[model samples]
Target: MKEFTFTITDPQGIHARPAGLLVKEAKKYAATLTILKGTKKGDLKKIFTVMGLGVKQGETVTVQAQGADEDAAAAAMEAFLKENF
Candidate 1:
């Protein structure tokens, strides 16, 4: 498994558009990906699950991946957040 902690930088936070992008990225990986906020965690591949966390700008969230391509998944997700959000 691999994990990365990132702060949400987008002014709109992880709204529908960003959440949709996240889910799209997550779906490309064979690994299982999860996003964590506080005590809540949800599958990254599911748009609703990610949006349900109510992530806000400047808030910290953890991205985790498990399975064969965990490292690539984590790196891609981290890169996505850093570059896009």
Candidate 2:
């Protein structure tokens, strides 16, 4: 498993649009992606699951990618967060 933590920088947090983009990005990989906030975890490929996370600005979001493409997926996810979050 490959994992990294990122603090949300978007003023609105992980709202609908970004959640949708995240889901889209996650779908491009076969890895199983999960985002953990405290004790809660949500599938990164699911819109509702991700949106329901209620991630807030400055909150640490831990992303874990597991599967064949985990390394690439994790890197892509990190870049995605940095570029858009």
Candidate 3:
């Protein structure tokens, strides 16, 4: 398993557009990906769950990836967050 925390930098937080894009990217990996906001957790491959977290700007969230290709998933997700949020 791989995990890390990343703070939201986008002024609008995740919203729908970015969340959809994230889900699209996440679907490429076989590993399971999840994001946590406080006590709320959501699957990265599901846009609705991600948006349901209600993550806001400046809030830090933990991302976890497990199973086959977890390392690659983690690396890609980290890069995506850095580049997008």
Candidate 4:
């Protein structure tokens, strides 16, 4: 498994548009992706689960990628977080 931590910079946090985009991005990978916020975890492929976390600005979240393409998925996820959040 591969993982990276990210702090949300967006004022609105992981709102609808980005959440949708995030789910879309997650679906591109063969690896399984999970987003962790404190003790809460949400499947990256699931929009409702992600939004259910209520990730807010200034909060740090960990993203884990596990499976065949975890390495690539982790790198891409990190880049995506940096660019978007």
Candidate 5:
């Protein structure tokens, strides 16, 4: 398993647009991707669960990938967050 933590920088937070994009990106990987905010966890491949978190600006979230391509998946998720969030 591989994981990384990121603090949201976007003023708008992880709203609908980015959440949809994030889910799309997550589907590209075979690994199981999960985003955790506090005690709440969401499947990265599912947009509703992600948006359900209501991740706001300045909040920290941890992303975990566990599967055959965990390394690449985790790296991609980190880069995606940095580039888009």
Candidate 6:
């Protein structure tokens, strides 16, 4: 498993578009991807699950990936957050 924490820097936070993008990216990997906000964690491949977390700007969330391509999943997610959020 691979994991890293990142702050939501986008002013709008993890809204529909970003969450959709996240789900899309997550789908590209064979690993299971999840996002943790506080004590709540949800599957990254599902948009509804991610949106249900109600993550807001400035919140620190943990991105976790577990499976054969965990490292790649983590790196891709980290890059997305850096470039998009």
Q: For candidate 3, write residues 1-80 as lDDT tens digits.
A: 99999999999999999899999999999999999999999899998899999989999999999999999999999999
lDDT of each: 0.93, 0.95, 0.95, 0.94, 0.96, 0.92
RMSD of each: 0.6, 0.5, 0.5, 0.6, 0.4, 0.7
lDDT per residue as tens, model 4, 1-85: 8988999999999999998998999999999999999999989999999999999999999999999999999998889889998
Over 1-85, each residue of candidate 1 has an lDDT whose tens digit, in order, gives 8999999988888999978998998999999999999999999999899989999999999999999999999999999999888
Segments in model 2 whose C-alpha atoms lie over 4 Å from true places: none
lDDT of 2 at 32: 97
lDDT for each residue of candidate 5 in 1-85, tens digit (9 for 90 to 100): 8989999999999999999999999999999999999999989999999999999999999999999999999999999999998
Q: Which residue pairs clash within candidate 4?
A: none
> Highest TM-score, which number?
5
lDDT of 3: 0.95
Candidate 5 worst ten-residue window by lDDT? 42-51
The reply for model 3, stretches above 4 Å from the true place, is none
- In model 4, what is the error at residue 81, expressed in angstroms? 0.9
Error of 4 at 32 (Å): 0.8
**In terms of lDDT, which candidate is strongest?**
5
Over 4 Å off, model 6: none
TM per candidate = 0.97, 0.97, 0.98, 0.97, 0.98, 0.96
lDDT of 6 by residue, 1-85 (tens): 8999999988898999988988998899999999999999989999999999988889999999999999999999999889988
Over the stretch 1-85, how does candidate 2's per-residue lDDT look in tens digits? Answer: 9999999999999999988998999999999999999999989999999998899899999999999999999999999999999
Q: After superposition, how far is residue 19 of candidate 3 from its true place, in Å?
A: 0.6
